[model samples]
Target: VRGTMRHLLVLALAAALLPVASVAAEESDVVVLTSQNFEHDTQASTGATTGDWFVKFYAPWCGHCKKLAPVWDELATELKGVVNVAKVDAEAHSSLRKRFRIRGYPTLIFFSQGKMYKYEEKRSLESLVAFAKGGYKDDTEAVDVPAPPDLIATLKGEFFGLLKTVLHYSKHPEAISQESAYFLAAGIVIGSVLASAFYLFLSLASPAPAKRVSQSKKGD
Candidate 1:
């Protein structure tokens, strides 16, 4: 009989703790965003899609960010099904940091209906949760989220592209080999000469506009 009572008490205790475990699981639902997938995921939230996002642009070592970590977790749990809570490590992802022009450590941005609303209020759990859950409508300051960067163009610019390479080598001559600098200069000169030759050829090839003449009739 004692063993049976013990089993019943253990089951009751486990039932009581199940909610705490569930809450812990919910808290971990905050999405971790990096530069690669940032635009794709955020762009999906625009224009009638249900996954509106509340994103925290934070540095991992920032003191204020560290302080708000738990509250941010709680906010995610509170607004789980209503709004998607996500975070980015700006210190690690320099591209996103530059893209958003994030100057501060912990910047909160809520994206909904193709607009971005910066959160400037106090970073309490209530404030964060409220802002995520349609409280952003009260604020008058909102801006359209910047368009997604073209992957191919971005890759080209980051690596070796014609114009970007020319500009870079022109501005910072010490960055490349001497042969590369000479080639860049030659490319610029050749491009200019070709453009001028094309203009001259077009001018000489096309006929001039015809002139209209009017004369009085002698019969008048």
Candidate 2:
């Protein structure tokens, strides 16, 4: 009776540990990569030459990234044969971040055929699987504007429109007033110069990752 009880206890313990062992085995296949290893892995795989798509951007401190980690891991496991999932820490790899122009944390950048698309918005195992099966289509709406015939023609038309307006005011100087016309032209020139400078300043003011992280910390 004592031997039987011991045998039963051992079996129960093994049964409990079996699932944990299976889970560990599944996790073992999932790869976690740093920024330093990203480029080398990408080059070696050549963007998963065997019908595998690559997801290559993440940030460790991001809540969204942490939330998505398990989903991403499941995706890797589910699509092991179909696609290869990889990650890079955006904060750790300044060079990679600059090279890719990563703008946000938890950004999922998909790579295939030497091209990359930023996977913006919510990420889940299902969504990623769908993206892998079909190509990732950005959620942004594209507005198509027809190009003018030529740069010279477009500039000429703009110049003529301005000239015509000026001529109208000049012809009716008594009605519109010369002072008003001079002031209007001056205001237009000044506005254009100021607008240009403002845009230039904004472009230069774009924040770096480290700066953004520090700013976020201060805000918190």
54-153 per-residue lDDT for model 1 (tens digits):
9999864467987887888888888888898988866545556666778998999888888888999999998888787778989548787776555533
3 in model 2: Cα distance from truth in Å? 73
Best by lDDT: 1
Clashes by residue pair, model 1: none
Query: What's the TM-score of each model vs. the native?
Result: 0.55, 0.46
Candidate 2 wrongly placed segments (more than 4 Å): 1-28, 44-51, 137-220
Query: Which sections of candidate 1 miss by over 4 Å?
Result: 1-27, 44-50, 152-220
Predicted structure 2: lDDT:
0.49
Q: What lDDT does the true structure give each of the candidates?
A: 0.62, 0.49
* Candidate 1 to truth, TM: 0.55
lDDT of 2 by residue, 1-220 (tens): 3344344334323322221111112233355553334544554324434444556566544667767777877888887876678776554334455556678777776665555566655576677777776546556332221222333332223333333333444444443323233433443343333333434444465554464343455657
